[model samples]
Target: MKTVAICSGKGGVGKTALACSIAAIIAGDQKRVLLFDGNLGLPNCDVYCGIEVGCTLGHIVRDGRELRDAVVPTKAGFDLISGGSGWKELAQLEGAEIDALVGDLMVLADTYDHVLIDCAPGVGNRVFPFLRASQGLMVVTTSEAASLMDGYALLKNAWDVNPSLTAGLVVNHVGSPAQGRGVASEVQGIVGQFLSQELEYWGSIRHDSLVARACAERRIFASAFPTAGPSQDLVDAANAIMGLGVEAEATEEISMLGRIKSVFGKKTEDSEDKAA
Candidate 1:
């Protein structure tokens, strides 16, 4: 499966909602999609997708459950692996614990078409593994100054980890087309100037009452209001994400630990040539 890390350095940018929606859209296209909530500290993907928590990553680490055992099917047409809210240990997991989690996730590469990791806000032990292992990075941000700065920080952190990993931007809760493009432009300019990195404009989601209602009701917005403009925007964005092409590892036949390590310990020269 192609793993995509959906992240934002700052919270309240609607990252979880976008990830869940993208999963739902891709799953509808006869693709087996897995949405793994990587926000171990403040996981709310389950809440946004309107699914119940069963076992989570915590189960695998703390309870000795298999990775697949934590899979929960959502009505939105995709499978989900919740990060298990309220588990302080999960939020602070690092080193060997993080390795074990990534190793297990690598085992499911053949089971799904895509695995979208809804990453937690900020960087560090819990988030790095996912970003390193992913073939795609989707940075969710808003026109707000704080979200822009923090989102850029998250992208820069990812670049530091994997310089070849190009990221796409999705400006959420935009007030207007001008506002959305302006946000994308600001980030693009900053990245090009400071980081010398390219950022793709995946598109934007306008603020909508249905989205607010979905969050308030703990449901997926596209499923609740498929006809909404913002819902269509999400569909377009999901298509763009699916269109992203990544060079698959030729040697996935190695051991799970080896495979995960290959990604975690990869060098920039061994990865995509900083192209596209």
Candidate 2:
């Protein structure tokens, strides 16, 4: 399965909402999509979709429950592995524990066409494992200056962990497509010039009040307000993602456990270098 991680450096950028809408759009197209909420500390995919989650990854980690048992069905036609909110222990997971959890989640690879991970905001430990494990990474941001900076930071952090890693950008809460394109271009230019990295523009989500209303109602905006501007934007973005043509051979080369260990080793080497 092709896995994608939806993340941002700052919160309140509509990351989760966009993730849900994109998953809904993909599922609507008859593709088997699994929405795995990887936002451990403040999981809200279930809340955003208005579905009551019976269990979560928290249960699997804390209570020794089976991973499949935590799979919760959603009205969006995609199964959800809810990241139940307020699981503090998740923020403190070590490398081995992360490897175990990811290894279990990997078993679903053969079962779905896409597995979208709604990762936590920021470039913390909780977010890296998901980012490293995924085939594609989509960084969400707004038109604001602070948001762009943080989004760039997220991109830079990801590249620092895996320099070969490439990511796409989604400008949310924009007034128009031109505005979104402008913002994406600025960020892309900066990253390419300074960090020598490349970022793809995956399209943007317009600032539609209907999206907030749908979220307030705990529903997928693509379903609740399909005709809305933001909804259409999400659909377009999802289509772009599908067209990304992620290489199956490259995806197969990514072992979550190995990636985690490699990242740890890199960090350790960097630390020792600085100490010298």
TM-score of each: 0.86, 0.86
After superposition, candidate 2 runs with Cα above 4 Å error: 246-276
Alpha carbon lDDT at 49, candidate 2: 89
lDDT computed for candidate 1? 0.84
Candidate 1 lDDT, 1-276, residue by residue in tens: 678899988888888988988898898888899998888788778888877787877776687778899899999889999887788778778778887788788787569988898988888878888888887899998888888889888998998887777589999998876788888988899899998999989888999988888888998888888888888888867887677663234333446668677776675445555552
Q: Which residue pairs in candidate 2 collide?
A: none
Residue range 70-121, candidate 2, lDDT tens digits: 9877888988998787776765677778767777787875699988888889
Error of 2 at 62 (Å): 1.8
